[model samples]
Target: MSGHSKWHNIQAKKGKIDAKRGKIFTKLGKEIAVAVKTGGANPDGNSKLRDCIAKAKAANMPMDTITKAIKKGSGDMEGVTYEEIMYEGYGPAGVAMLVNVLTDNRNRSASDVRCLFDRNGGNLGANGCVSWMFQRKGQIVIQRQDGMDEDELMMKVLELGAEDFAAEEEVFVITTSQEDFSSVREALEKENFEFESAELTMIPDNTVSLSMEDAERVQKLVDKIEDNDDVQNVWHNAEFPEDFEE
Candidate 1:
């Protein structure tokens, strides 16, 4: 499997825990709120909000909670207003890291993120330090089902403008240019396809392989950063050894 596919598979396994599920909902709520604030409340008119809603539903977030987040962002209800921020850093083995956060207090988030890196044998860097090593792409993941035809799926995705496709052990990963993400996703949805996850992501151009010990340290650092309520996504270029335990 590709490094990205392996990382995502590990994450999927970890997300089965109840505590992680709650954290996932909280993060999705923040995303919905921010999407509503940036692009109006109506999904038909706001592509970002529509995508957030779809993600929220996929995560099984309660309808009422989703509605409340929308209301909060649309000014119908009072709530914390979050600002998006990006933090760049390097983890163990010189692995480049990018953290995306939605924070009401930038200073607190920055301090927390930096401390995680420092304590985990990494260092936070100035803006643009590691970003140049990655490219923005739209990624969609669908769980592979019994008797699923890979050829058919590839053809379907290519016709819908997807840039690439990979059939991993448990899921099919599809990549698309950012501009074609929405249309491709809509087309797939119309065909009644269920997705494991779908979102715009930063993909590393190259990866840094790490020893088992260093890989563990980097994974811990990533977990700590992701557990922070303000953090939305954590991207990295660390490639664990093929035989490394999850």
Candidate 2:
């Protein structure tokens, strides 16, 4: 579950996610289920499951729902089996895109996604076609409240050895290497910090800049793909215009 988050304030992003909470929960629940089936239900001993739980919580998924998903994954409860798949593609402006999906029927998903691309000025490519252009990184976002001091927060982030930091107008974004993600998140928790969202995300090595019209077209294509029940995320390298309004 990822997005071009650096382009928008985390708070506003949260609002958009909230609007689609049901679909997000379904996707996250599938992730939790698959993580458990693969590694076991114990988050402590299963880092993948642990990370999935953290992401589920960040999306404001209900605690009871989270517990049920764990149980379903562990086979204590009945649930449909789902498999994870990622589709690579290019959007309207040659913007590299990755669509993450979890489904019980691979053929149905592949056909549906290909049709979406065909109709939306995109081309679904073979696996690994665009994955190389992205890097997986850990990201933690904290909203800037009235009492938060940017310098003090940045100092803490630096001391924690995050790879990068950005203090946006309404939030603080801390990024770490993949291996350091869990430790950094734990450290922040010890200091009683709350995150708007914390998880591993794909960041593009470089972004594609297009005219405003093309950028909007790409965004529209992304939205259309995301509206599908089986699509978990749509990650793209479109560099949104600074003047763009949410």
Against the reference, the lDDT scores of all candidates come to 0.83, 0.82
RMSD of each: 2.2, 3.0
TM-score (C-alpha, index-matched) for candidate 1: 0.91
lDDT by residue for model 1 (17-129), tens: 24588878878877987888889899899999888887776666789999988987788535667789999999988999999999999999999999999998899999999
Candidate 1 CA-lDDT value: 0.83
**Candidate 2's residue-wise lDDT over 143-203, tens digit each?**
7889998888888877887888787777788888888888888798788888889888888
Question: Which candidate should be chosen as best, given TM-score against the real structure?
Answer: 1
* Residue 230 CA displacement from its true place in model 1, Å: 1.1
Alpha-carbon shift of residue 224 in model 2 (angstroms): 1.5
Q: Which whole-number lDDT from 0 to 100 does residue 71 have in model 1?
A: 85
Among all windows of ten consecutive residues in candidate 1, which has the lowest summed lDDT?
1-10
Stretches > 4 Å off in candidate 2: 1-13, 76-80
The local lDDT score (0 to 100) that residue 127 gets in candidate 1 is 100
